[model samples]
Target: MDTLHIVCPACQTTNRVRNDQLGAHPDCGRCKQPLFQGRPVVLDEAAFERQRTRSELPLLVDFWAPWCGPCRMMAPAYEQAAALLEPHMRVAKLDTEQAQALAGRLNIRSIPTLALFVGGREVARQPGALTRADDIVRWARSQLATA
Candidate 1:
């Protein structure tokens, strides 16, 4: 059985899960919560670092602001993508307004930017919030190819 280590955004706990169980709704070992719920998991700096460094799967990070209309619109698409990609990829969201330091460090000047990370390093970034879910999925798949 294939296993992947996923960092919990809520509790910062590392959970090992079967790769095949990702899309089937795997829960955290510590928190007992669904690993890939439709909502974006909030991550702080330390949690982000842990997830980026330890995860065996590719990560899709959505950098967004709560007040932005496009960001709000993209939320559902992101959630859908998460639900679809679960065990294959690690999906997360960061609120730009709250994660100011992270945003500054990443040089994100846009409201809704998406970054694909693999092995703790960024591979690709999507600027603007007008992108469709299919396009985002395709881009992520391409990044996975490079990793």
Candidate 2:
């Protein structure tokens, strides 16, 4: 069986999880928290800083706002993309409205934007909401290949 390396969201401890168990409730080896939670784990400044530096897998961050229609539409696609790319990439969502400071610091100019970060460096960004899951997944896969 194939396995994937994951950095625990709670403890930041690295865990090796079986690929087949990804869809199931895989627990962190250190903290015993569920690993494949559907929602994007919200990160604060320190957690974001730590994740950007320590995550071995690629990261796909969705910058969105709650009231934006397009952002709402894109939420499901983001979730689907996350499920598809698990064990290979880490998917996170940042509420630009809530995380305005970070958004401004990152120079985010749009409501629904997708950013791909690898090894703590942002490699690519796309503005506007994605209409399809394939588009999001394709972009992330390209980033993974090029990174």
Candidate 3:
């Protein structure tokens, strides 16, 4: 059977799940937390690295800072995009303030940047706050198609 590697949001454990079991709401082997929660997972640098490198699923990371107005404004739309995109793709958020070094390494020069990673490499990046859920979904799908 084909399998997909999914990183647990709660514990950052990489779980090997059969592709057929994705819709069954697979739980983490290490933490037993549901894998797809219909919301963006908050990731620190370590967890972020693990998920970005190990998971077979495409990872959509929202680079945001707590104090940025546009970032705060886009949070709800990002959450909605998570609801629509999960189980096929993984959506995560990294607080730029908390992951300062990681942000610098990624060369993030703006708030509310959206970067899509597939197979451990960044395939596309958009620097700005996206306020509409449909727009976010559309952009992600388009990028994945081209990727």
Candidate 4:
């Protein structure tokens, strides 16, 4: 059976999930939290690194700041996109205010940036607030297809 490496959103421990069991509401072996909760997982720098580098799933990271108006406006749309994208890809959010160093390392020049990472490398990035859920989903799917 093929297994996918998934990093626990709550515990940061990597869990090996069988492909056939992905839709069965898999739980983390360490923290026992549901793996795919149909919401974007919030990540700190270290946990972000683990999910991005260690997990086999494609990762879509939204780098945003609380004070940014565009970022705030895009929040709900991003969440909606998460619901549409999960099981195939993992969606996560990284606050620029909390992870300033990480934001700097990624050279994030805008208030809201959407980056697609596959196999630990950033494949594409969109530096703006995508307000529509369909737009976000389409853009992500296109990026992944090209990646």
Candidate 5:
């Protein structure tokens, strides 16, 4: 069976999971934590780098600041999108306020930016808030399809 490398959200361990068992709710081999919690993992700079570089799965990151209204408003939709997308890909959130240097390095000039990363490099980016879960899913999938 085909397998993919997944980074555990809880402990940052890399796990090899069978493709067929993706929807089976796989657990991390080393950490014993559920691989997919059907929600976006809250990321610090170190965790973001670990997940982006170590996992074979594509990553979708939301760059937001706490004071941004659109970012706050879109959080619910992003969470729903995570529920629909996990096990196939990873979804994460990074607070610009919390990771200032990382955010500046990434050149995040705006709040509520969605960036899709494959093979540890950003492939596509969308700048703005998407209020609907369906829209977020569609946009991310479409970006992956093109990438």
Candidate 6:
């Protein structure tokens, strides 16, 4: 069976998981913490880069500022989407307010932007809030499908 490198959200350790075991509730080799938490992991610039570059799985990032009302409104929906997408992909949130340089590097011009990454490269980007979980999932999946 093929294996993939998954970055542990808890410990930042890299683990190898079999292709067939992705949905089997795999644990991190180093931290023994569940790899898929069914929720989005909060990320800093370093953590974001590590997961993006190291993991074989696709990454969905929500870039938002704390003061942005649209971002606050979309948080719950993003959380719901995380629950649905985990085990197949990794979901994370990056606070653009805290990581201004990183946000600038990504050219994030708007709050509540969603970017999907595959193999360390951005595959698609959507700006503005997606207030529904289904919409977020549908958009991410569509982008991944095309990628």
Full-model lDDT, candidate 4: 0.94
Backbone clash count for every predicted candidate, in the order shown: 0, 0, 0, 0, 0, 0
Please give the lDDT score for candidate 5. 0.96
RMSD of each: 2.0, 2.9, 0.7, 0.8, 0.7, 0.7
lDDT for every model?
0.80, 0.81, 0.95, 0.94, 0.96, 0.95
Candidate 4, 35-94: lDDT as tens digits: 898989999999899999999999999999889999999999999999999888999999
Q: Please identify model 3 stretches exceeding 4 Å from their true place.
A: none
* Candidate 3 residue-wise lDDT, 25-95, digit = tens: 89999989999999999999999999999899999999999999999999999999999998999999999
Candidate 4 matches the true fold with a TM-score of 0.97
Candidate 1 clashes between residue pairs 3 or more apart in a chain or in different chains: none
lDDT of 2: 0.81
TM-score of each: 0.85, 0.82, 0.97, 0.97, 0.98, 0.98
Clashing pairs in 5: none
lDDT of 2 by residue, 57-141 (tens): 6778888888999999998888888877875677888887777899999999997999988888999999999978888999889
Tens-digit per-residue lDDT, 25-112, candidate 1: 7778898877676655677677778888987778789999889999999888887777666667778888888879989999999978
- Candidate 5 Cα errors over 4 Å, as ranges: none
Model 4 residue 23 CA deviation (Å) reads 1.6
Model 6 regions more than 4 Å off: none
Q: How accurate is candidate 6 locally (lDDT)?
A: 0.95
Q: What is the lDDT of residue 122 in candidate 5?
A: 97
Report the candidate with higher lDDT, 1 versus 3.
3
lDDT by residue for model 6 over 42-112, one digit each (tens)? Answer: 99999999999999999999999889999999999999999999989899999998999999999999888
